[model samples]
Target: MMRIAIVGAGIVGLAAAHALLDKGHQVTLVDPGNNQQRPTDGNAGWIAHMDVMPLASPKAWRNLPRWMMDPLGPLTIRPAYLPALTPWLLRFVLASSPARIKSSIAALRAINAEALPSWKALLTTLSLNGHLREKGILSVWRDRNHFLRAEDIITRQKNFGIPLEVLQPEDLKQIEPALHSVEAAVLYPEGCHVSDPALLAADLLRLALERGAVLVSAKALAVEPANDAVHIRTDGAVKDVTADRVLISSGVWSRALAKQLGDNIPLDTERGYNATYAKGAFGLNRPVMFEGEGFVASNLDTGDRVGGAVEFAGTQAPPNHERTSAMITRLKRFLPHLDENQPAKRWMGFRPSIPDSLPVIGQADKDKRIVYAFGHGHYGLTQAAITSRLITEMMEGKPGSLDLTPFSAQRF
Candidate 1:
């Protein structure tokens, strides 16, 4: 059996570790002790198949000014960093062209299509639903013009056999009484939600430990390909870890580690903010997306978590609790009855994003035994299992379950 080292503990790393272990491989998961590293604890916990489009679409450019200037806006980009990311933005615009978007949407849809089956398999194996609600996700638009604009993209998405239901304003009102202000809604039947992603990951960690995988609280400093194994150096000590494979699923930090091995990926973190109300604002039967606002909400037994914001500066940016409060403010507009009196537990985490807003998933080089499963942006929760199975397949000398052409490291 091949020995593999996975460097991250987020959904991707956990998924990879699970897949590797199932194949009878020796796996070691390394993560820095809770300080400067990315945490998988704070996401809104969605496994959506409807959000198959890249963040850098035509509409992004149109809304750039407002997203940048308004701190409370759903999307924000630091103006100081714009020049450095201009080339990426240009490429994003190019990729959002009619032809490119069609192709991207196709690939994303394929990845998304694979998500449900993989999730079902994992859920069955784990025997813990832990709020694995298949209650569909709905995207609501405030005006007919917005829905009409999205219809073009929706038509192309339909070609991929995605299950989408377009709802009129009146129909949307019945579905989401809290959102009558919206003119229309698109319901994605295949979307999934997790009440608590952290609890889910904690369960996965428990399983990994039970399966003999070691979780080290040490930070990896560097790696060098030694005689037949890759020698890993951590902050504590240098250890000769002879592994046949190394999968980098280290989120935003993966870029630096991968760069150490001659891969240059321009990865930026999408700093996200979330607030959890211990007592739900109102009874939400499912997850809801506010399109024009770029925000989302979910009702869970534990509480209602309202979140959304894409500020691309760095994950370490100060916790702009004001932004989190603004999300609550925005929600009040949609669901007037939502009780804002409950104590809020605010959270922020960095989602590593590429310019095209696609994750990097594939073998780094044919000659080397390194694989990449990082830069998943916002879809890490959605694409975890599929990426794990694909990466594990590649490591086992078996063909990857899907075409990895779309998420190659060379694209950067």
Candidate 2:
């Protein structure tokens, strides 16, 4: 069996490690201090096969101003950093072209369909429940004009065979009896959700331990590319570990390490803020999203979770707790009965974003014994399993189930 090292213990790394083990490789998973929470824990927890478009869409561009202004806005690029953020933003607009968007959505759909089954299979093997349910995702539109605007994209989704369904108010109520208010909602029956991402991550790690994967609680200090293997350096006086291959899945911090391997990926972190309210305050039988604000609200048996926004700032910037509260407040606006003042929990996690809103998932330079599997942007949770499976196939010197060209490391 080949010996391999995986950096980052987030969902991506964990999934990669598990796949490597299945391929009969001895895997060592590494990570930093876990000083910060991972986005895999706070995301909307969707595995959406129907919502196939990248975040770099024309609709997103049109709403950029509203998405940037209010500190509570969904997509925020700090005003002071506009000059610095222009290139990434510009490339994003360019990728929003009709041709590229279609190709991207096609790739996304293939990857997601390949991923969904793996998630269920793995979760079943681990005997862990993240409260995953495949009742699908419903996108509700409060404004008729917005609904009409979204119809064109809905057509695209239908063309892709995305299992689309437009529900009127009565149909919406029947499908989601607990729903408080809705003008219209479109359900993607092929979608799924994990009620709690934190628990899922922790449980997956536990299962990895049972499968003989070691988790050393120290940060990776450095990695030296050797002729036949890669040597990993850790904190304190711990001896360096050597492996036949190294995979970096360190999320937003991955770019720094990636630079060591000769890649100049334009990776920037997009902080996603979330508010988790105590049990039964808000009502939702299925997930509900406000496409305009990038806000999502769902009912967990224990509580309610409202996640929203994309703040292009680093850990250096203090989290805007008020911004997280805004997600809850915004949800209240959608459902008037939802009490805005209810005691809620707030948190923020960074999602590493690339210019094209696509993850980098391939090998690095030949001189460097490393492969990249980071920069998943808003869809990391949605795409992790297939990514791991793909990386594993490549590591085994076999072809991956699908083409990896679109997700190449040098796409930037």
TM-score of each: 0.93, 0.94
> lDDT of each structure?
0.78, 0.78
User: Where does the lowest 10-residue lDDT sum fall in candidate 2?
Assistant: 29-38
lDDT for each residue of candidate 1 in 1-412, tens digit (9 for 90 to 100): 9888888888889988888888899998887747433546777788886666777676666667766678678886677767766766677667777777766776788788898788778777778665488888988877678778877668866876778898767777777676646667888887778867787888888899899898877677776676678766777543544577888888988878888888888787778888888654655678888876867887765678888788766654576777888878887877887777778888888888887777898766533688889988888888998999989888888877788888889875
* Pairs that clash in candidate 2: none
The digit string of per-residue lDDT tens for model 2 on 3-111 reads 8988888889998888888877888877654555578777777776566668877778767876666767787767676777787778877888988887787777778
Off by over 4 Å in 1: 35-39, 237-240
Which portions of model 2 show Cα errors greater than 4 Å?
177-181, 236-239, 366-368
